[model samples]
Target: MAEKGDFKHEHMADEANDNDTVDFSNNISARIKNPLAGIRQDVLLRDVEEFAAMYDLSDITPLLKKGALVAQNPADFENVEGLDDTERDVLRDEVVHKWRQPRALYTTVILCSVGAAVQGWDQTGSNGANLSFPVAFGIGDTDPTSPNYTRDLWLVGLINAAPYIASAFIGCWLSDPLNNYFGRRGTIFFSAIFCLLSVIGSACTQNWWELFICRLLLGIGMGSKASTVPIYAAENVPALIRGGLVMSWQMWTAFGIFLGTCANLAVYNTGAISWRLQLGSAFIPAVPLVIGIYFCPESPRWLMKKGRYSQAYKSLLRLRNHPIQAARDLYYVHAQLLIEHKIIGQTNYAQRILELFTIPRVRRATLASFTVMIAQQMCGINIIAFYSSSVFQQAGATVLHSLLASFGFGLVNFVFAFPAVWTIDTFGRRALLLFTFPNMAWTLLAAGLCFLIPKDSSAHLACVALFIYMFAAFYSPGEGPVPFTYSAEVFPLSHREVGMAWAVATCLFWASVLSITWPRMVAAMTPTGAFGFYCALNLIAFTMIFFWVPETKQRTLEELDYVFAVPTGKHMKYHMTKSAPFFFKRYIAMNKNATLEPLYRFDNVQSDAVRSASVTAYNQEHRKSETTKKLNL
Candidate 1:
């Protein structure tokens, strides 16, 4: 089994011509179009001996001459200097090409999405509950002029936020152990069962305390499912589809919220008991999740981690279209496992947590994930998701009108979710974050500004609602889904489940802090003030994304390990543009030995529409290649 870069038979004379490296610019798009798509591992790993001697110029020039590899970017050169350029290229490209998409892959992603939907539905129902349940329980008055007008700020805040303590902390903490023992599917299965009981209990609550207990239980399931599903989808799908599929978890969560909003609208005027039915409908989605999850294929990476090699192979075969493709994927899974096993050794939870911070690449990944999760919750979208009905009511809508507006919020969330899945792989995760966060900040500020206009004016309220809708439009593509998809690809299988739990726990922390204290935030500062705070948070998120996050659109999970591991330098960020002289000047300053050519594959022209348009070209090329080899020739 020679490494795939072995050009012993195919290109020896070409390799011997040191200056004959062909122009790769034309094919760079082909490579960029599917950086993480799989090619055969056997084709990638055939030149073991030559690649092993990569430090010797004699060993390196051959592969470079063969046009099978290129030099690392100026930033990456220091770290990867020992490896020949061609070996790295094949290593990345093959991993992408080796995977053949399978039908079961989609089935598994959809099943996991049920858990996401369950979480969304639960959140939206509670948002609606805040509309009518406060009055029903005799805790607060919707009308300030009523006889029973006291807000009961303590009880109201407790009722609203008690769920977070359970869901964010306890539920998220529980996910790591559950995911470790039962795997992602089993964990989501148990979460669905718990949610079934919790949803019923919530609807039947007689007091604020009873409702709080029920919601706390609901949080347990919501938190677990939220933490587990994205990574499960990431592991099962090929990279070409990974962003779209993993993002669908968020989309389905939006779907669940849509169902919840529609339920609320149905029951808004049906008397005191209508809230109960609104809450109870959440149980229905859980029923399918509990039953369907067990039938879907488990993550092959997880199977391999547990030493069930045969089962891992079977699972991969079901997920991939070709046998050799399945085997090749397993080889990388095994290779990464072996590499980590020897270096990482045996570790306890404490050690793993410590390593999560200490390991340079993994730590950067964790920080990036944790930062995005925190930013996402704090970006002010949740304010709308959890309380749009109230925001509408406060803005001048009647109770029914507010409920209808909330339904629109959910509808927008659900409708825009489709675009994220369609474009996430091409648009690139970092680009979306960079582009959308500023727009979200401005839209929220505009909505807040609209509040300062004269009271009882329908025009002012309409402006505020319009701003909220626009805010949601910006949020759906980037902040809504990219965080989960980005978090899923950063960790190796060894730490993936627990690593994801940690990222989700960051959500728990922010969601808890934000959800628990939202009322106080609005009361202490005016609503306008609160919105201003979130606007600042979005700007902070934009700053972090600009400097820290790398483009991870088309790269494989393993290939991303290399992307994040690139040497960190403060000066490296500004020169990332397309100017060749700027990059060459910087390259010379750092390393004179490496060649002076532009190192990165993508350019500024990679807009969402442009990136998405190229996928058809790749597919057409692939179809043409297959036809060329067939008897139709």
Candidate 2:
């Protein structure tokens, strides 16, 4: 009997060994076949209750503790390496995918559309108001050489600069904190309220100062949108489709500018209805945006990162069609935070912005983003946008003619920006920046010379107009979207909002200075001199892009850190994977698509800790099984 029992025990031991061998073989084989596959393998949803329970006792315990995934154990803890492989995998999965789907991309589009429309309305509203302001304010007819003309132009310049200046400082303050505090939808709601107040104030303004104040108030909302919209999009989308989604906002912004131009033309032609209707019409676009954003899902990341994992999971399920996918994504996000040693509550507002500049890698990214934003502003694009009508009028076009020309410029901007939206992922940042700068500089220089030439000659006027068209077309791809996209990309996931705010604030600062100064500069230098100055500034920017700007076209946010934050040796040759016929190897490098996947979904199962609270869910499911058993009985 003893011998028989020993034999049976040995047989059981052998079976256990065989099972272990099978599992190990499968795991090893999977790793061998695809090395990078495991990076995102955790994105697949599994049984959350089982995973959480298993992970609580395993290697991932340390990480769960670090990510605040598991509450701080009162007991002393072991290191992450101490956990066994399966437990570690569970913990890793917990960190990567969220339990919820992202807010619908369509929802994001609608929310951000308000911000973009605000940008357009402000740009065009001010443009239109500036066009008619001299007459509206009773300053007198605009003659470029007249002192009255210059003063009146400066007042118009103030109106254009007001929103930008206010947005620069105020936008930063409102965007990151409000996003954290109120959540994305709430922040957008407040922005809508601010915008509403701004519009109402503007409509009722009796004087220039009041109008300026109203514009300033409106700008706070606009600035908030500018900073938050892209951040919201980046946080909500998956890594696969990020570029297209973010740039779509830029596309709509350009579209808004186009619409604004059209509005300006209609108002200008209508006589007395001009400035009032033009400024008032600014409120139209944002109304839909506000309504859309109100109904959109919250950012799951913001919630999860804040230790509200259940809420994050629910948000994710709403964003994605597949519940498992959403859970998987949440796990990945947590995993990344664990690897980086980032804890959400540990970081406050100031710390977030400070962290962006304090880290070496982050500092490099800051510099790159800062330089790029500054370059975008100094490239003379806003100069044209803010003062295009004034510029055309000075070059000898009639007021009505200049308004038409401005509309034409907006049309060009709207048309050409579409290619940028499509190709930003395919062609890349380096290629676009490389080609755009020289084209704009040369064009601006030529246009400057045209202004310097005798104004009486139609040839000079034709040349100036031709260059303006070229400038707008070339600008469509780079300046219009790059500043916005780069700001979203440069910072780490945690620091995105504040870091973006800082960068955008800087842009607004420079924009304010430029918008305010350009009119006076034009008055002092004449159109020829102002254009020449811009041409020279752009030439310097061209040099910077060639030497400094890294190609970030399709890189994941993490991958982008390597290019921007990591330092390369001066003479080291940068090799990029070029997927091609091997012909364009020198000019083309491997650029990844900057697409982000959706981050919100519904029905994603969270941790067992949270799942236990969901008795209604299980009860509902068990009801059918119970009914079947009772019938059988």
Candidate 3:
């Protein structure tokens, strides 16, 4: 795809806009490709204001004088440009095969996904402990007649959400600086070591506050990996399978939830998992991740950002099929870096952090990323997962049945989440969110209403469990993985790490906020009000995604940068605040007067025209061979 599209644009540049040979800095040959060559002049004039509003005024000079794309290996470029139909098919197959290698995409997915599992362990393990811990630790005043017995709503909420609080404040922001200094592997290592300590502390605590303090420690480590893992995994794989690989982060999360529940099941009557063993079981995944993360390779793209071109090439070489293929992928990285050098000179950490909010497109990207993550937390899935056993007991099940039903729910969560691994890239992130949010809202409301029935009615209990499972079914693919996947891919490589870290911070903060409040909300108004609140959140999520989020399917990570297209910092506020966005248009042209018709033809406005149709088409085409077909396209 890179060869087919970039070559055509390069050919069009040479044929239509002949430029005089000019020497440029950084050994780049200067040539302004009139990317608008074949468009109608009237249409260009019609959308003149749109073009100017879309990009910054300050970027016009550099856009016009933009240097030509450079190749790391020129001969490999020739091979792609000269390929016949059969040769193209063979090459595509080879690319697919190489990407599927255990060491390449699969290994990256497994190691980074432990981040998700760590989250699941804390949540589900705690949920299982909730079954008996209140009584065991004298949490909520089992005997009103006894001395020192009081219902502490505020204390319970605080203890329940302690981990999320620590995660939001510490782990979330910590990833960016840790990533900057120690790189992705070091940050992940930091996360694992801390996660292990939190688990040990949680297991040994005798009182609720002790457990709360332990959870706080857990949040610190968990937050560290929350933002770092998905983008790290995404960076290592080809864009072809990027969604599937990144979604693995959530897949392992579901597995961890299941593991936590199973541990609960094993010790349910044995008197272990209630407070100690269930929390300690997080060590199962954390131990392996800590030992193995150091063995994983550093991101080639991160390497390029540091001016370590040789190491970047070597990393890509080990990941890709051949040195030529690695060089071709690395070429795009270098080309993007070279262009940025002309516009944004060496930026310190402080400057990059400032750019996250002040830069129009970066700000836009931040909002887009932040909104989905907030939606993910507020979507009510995790609430259902952490509170399912409690809800089961509320629905009139015995203690044993509630535990059994909770285990079943955990298994269902693990089973249902796999569909996303195949569908996310094909259906697109926004499409999935749009489809699932409505389903989640109604199901949650209906489940809450189920409580209106008699406690002894089997039908009511069954309906509640069914609603919870169906909600998970929708949520597993919807808000669950999409936030992590979408946030990882949207931001430019320049501030991608910082941007994603901020998104994760938003999630952690909200996760804590919601977790703390759910208990009090239920205690005050019953499950009905909590469910009603979740439904409202889902509706808002639908609206935000329908408008703000763009479909990022079938595009390379570098190509995705074009989606935002906001220029430099000088005129960013005007572009961001004052204008209606042209987000769907391809950002191939940067010239002041360039027409965008060639880049985004009339039929190609994805965010607007084809958004709904994508869900239907993607559903019909979801088979084992779907990946190969999409890549072959």
Query: Which tens-of-lDDT digit does each residue in 1-633 have in candidate 1?
Result: 222112122222222223222122122221222121122323333432243233132332333322221111211221333344444333343333423356688788887787777777867887888877887888875455655543554466666666566766778767777877898788988888888899899888898889889888888887788778888889888766689889988898889989999999887778888778877888888888898897898888777666665566678779876443454465444433443454345566667777788776677778778878888987988888877877787778888888888888898888987888767877778778877999999999999888898766768778888889899988998889998888888876666766787888788667767776776577667778888999998999887776667667766675555455554442143335433354455564664554443334442111222233344346657898998889566
Q: C-alpha displacement of 200 in model 2, angstroms?
A: 3.9
- Pull out the clashing pairs in model 3: none
Cα RMSD for predicted model 2:
13.9
Candidate 2 stretches with Cα past 4 Å from truth are 1-103, 138-154, 342-345, 558-565, 568-633
Judge candidate 2 at residue 554 and give its lDDT.
42
Give the alpha-carbon lDDT of every model: 0.69, 0.63, 0.67
- Writing each residue's lDDT as its tens digit, candidate 2 over 154-207 gives 776677788888889796578988887787778777777777668767866777
Alpha carbon lDDT at 597, candidate 3: 22
Report the alpha-carbon TM-score of model 1 versus the true structure.
0.77
Model 3 alpha-carbon miss at residue 91, Å: 3.3
- Local lDDT at 504 for model 1: 83
Q: Each candidate: how many clashes?
A: 19, 56, 0
Error of 1 at 160 (Å): 2.8
> RMSD to native for every prediction?
10.4, 13.9, 11.4
The alpha-carbon deviation from the true structure for residue 287 of candidate 3, after best TM-score superposition, in angstroms, is 1.3
Candidate number of the best lDDT: 1
- Can you tell me which runs of candidate 3 are displaced by over 4 Å? 1-90, 94-99, 142-151, 566-633
